[model samples]
Target: MSEILTITTDEVVPDREAVFEHQGIPAGRAVAAEIEALCTAAMEVFRQAAAPAGVLAEISKADFATLYKGDGQNEDATPVDEIYPRAKHLALFAVTVGEEVSRRIADGFKSKDFVDACMLDSVASASAERAVEIVQQRFLERATARSPAATKGEHRRLAGVPTGETPVPQFSSRAEKILDISSTGGDRRSPVDGVLAYSPGYCGWDISGQRKLFEFLKPETVGISLGESCLMQPLKSVSGVFIIGPKAIHLFDNCYSFCGRCTTHNCRDRIRALDAGG
Candidate 1:
């Protein structure tokens, strides 16, 4: 189906606070105990102060030959293939944490409570990230089951398990069964095949890109809107496109490699932390 597909779900707001591996909260990488205490307290407040905000999404893949086909993929094409090689499909998607979190932050700012504001920020970030995960999980399950990957035969690393690996298995009865099923032609289809997610104002994709995403996703169906500056209105919200092919791993792992493309240096640390995250 060439038409865009939409997904919606009520995600249980993740019950945790955002933490950085090298944050200088009280000081550089403050004691985990102290941070945990702070996070626990903040999360307690957030639990009541906020409610589960869901996710909204739109996903579609277009022919690479059009707006995104790299260079040599087509003989008439130019040098883009060198920059982004072997990209078979462009998967565009946008997901957002809902409006209630925004209400919490606005209320915090109104009272001039920085601590509360920061806690809310952590919760909002967690919620937004969760929103994307929820949407992706749903989309992938739906997409792969009905996608070409399922019907069209493609070479994928088939399910396999080696025998006599003491570290993993000691050639037990299960190992014999495993080796038997480890054939050359097996399907490992996934909607998130080497996905390279690009959010508006993120990963070198300019904030201005949100207009295109918004127009495509119509995120307003789930109460998401963009501000005049192209930032998603919920503040904690995120939007992006995905490149789902093997060549996209590098961008998916470190999107900031294209940092030079964006002029806004405001969120470098935050973006870096997210990229470095496991």
Candidate 2:
């Protein structure tokens, strides 16, 4: 079963700078009064129409194996292959700002209101991202709460573990099962202490993986759906697993065969942000 995550408009107010950047305008650039008015209007629509909500389900390490496949056998090893094995816990999640915002954006475009359509689209996109970020933070908080020591200010120091082998924060018998299932069983170095969300179609993980992910998550209860092309509907929705492991597991150079054809190296920025504790 999955848990429903409720969020408010205040939690995911679209960032003004992000909206401008999404619309191809640099942040802080002088804007015409009319454009500013349109931006304000877009924000109002987002505030009224947005219904940010999410659903997340914790999966056993065993289930993640089949869900992490690519197009075919012998496919290139993706970043997920390297990073997921080290995870102490994994949760599949999906978040969206909801369908009303999407409907309004479509209505704008249908009436040939390109400026309004673009503005609303940008705001909706930013709002959806913010919703996803909020969900991730909440999940991390719940994870921390599960660790009794973390609640008492002993987050960094494990009780009986040796100095170099300090287990990951919130380590449990479940983690031992994860270690046994993973190839890293015999290695006693503790799991890493960071949480990061990763999605399909990035870092060599095939977009086709979305089918399996959606099957397990069944985000339809939260009004998110997957398309035949493996794209999530509502266009602004984000879906993926929150991999809880060491920071080093997520570090990787984009040297895969697929990297040469890629245009956006967004993973570099994401990894850097993770390292910076963002």
Candidate 3:
């Protein structure tokens, strides 16, 4: 049986207004309030998507453990306390925007500095929304892919496809070839070219190593090549090591292959270890 999963949503504080003002934008309380509303709405969608199928449960601070499985080995792995002291399911929180927000920001852009900061914030917001959407879609895909095909007059299987079977249709040879190249290990190169060339949306990098890479590329520039397919979202900048549960960690690791042309050898090793049950 699938375990019950709980999801909670909350606003990320220290309002983006300060950041906006720092960039010379006239961000008053009104702007901050709107940003918070947008974040809350996006998070609600995320929370709804994350809950176990057909189990309507209220997500709150008390139930965070159900959603965020902590790292099995160390306290640092599941530092939900540090990441979301107010609530568990939320690991990192920040305000971000969609196309609508971007247009608004663009409308407010006055000078070069203002334009630059506004653009950066817009990218960050959009990126967050994209991240949430990608994660939710992945969950849906896995659940659906694992579900068995419906047999006419057969019992409805709500738990989704069974494990250890071919749940989805076979990939074409071309797709398999792309998957193989994308899944290659031990390289820290950008996987954008491969993923964009073969699949839709940009892929994620290893969380542990991405900070440095993000610093190198900067959030504003990271998704530029992907155009409308992948949006750049800025994660809250924070320090301290954080680790998720083994399963979640494994998921994040495998996602590296989706990155298309990554050069991080460690990520490949992690994927191999997970596959081997190490």
**Among all candidates shown, the one with the greatest TM-score:** 2
Q: Estimate each model's TM-score.
A: 0.57, 0.80, 0.22
Off by over 4 Å in 2: 70-75, 147-192
Model 3 Cα shift for residue 19 (angstroms) = 8.3
Model 3 global lDDT (CA atoms, 0 to 1): 0.29
- Ten residues in a row with the worst lDDT in model 3? 191-200
Give Cα-based local distance difference scores for all models: 0.45, 0.74, 0.29
Between which residue pairs do clashes occur in model 2? 192-246
Candidate 2 CA-lDDT value:
0.74
For model 2, residues 41-130, the per-residue Cα lDDT tens digits are 999988999888899998888898878773443237777787787666789999999889899999999999999989999999988888
Alpha carbon deviation, residue 33, candidate 3 (Å): 23
Task: After superposing candidate 1 on the true structure, give the runs of residues whose Cα lies further than 4 Å from its correct spot.
Answer: 1-12, 15-17, 20-35, 49-92, 147-192, 247-278
- Give the per-residue Cα lDDT of candidate 2 at 41: 95
- Top candidate on lDDT is 2
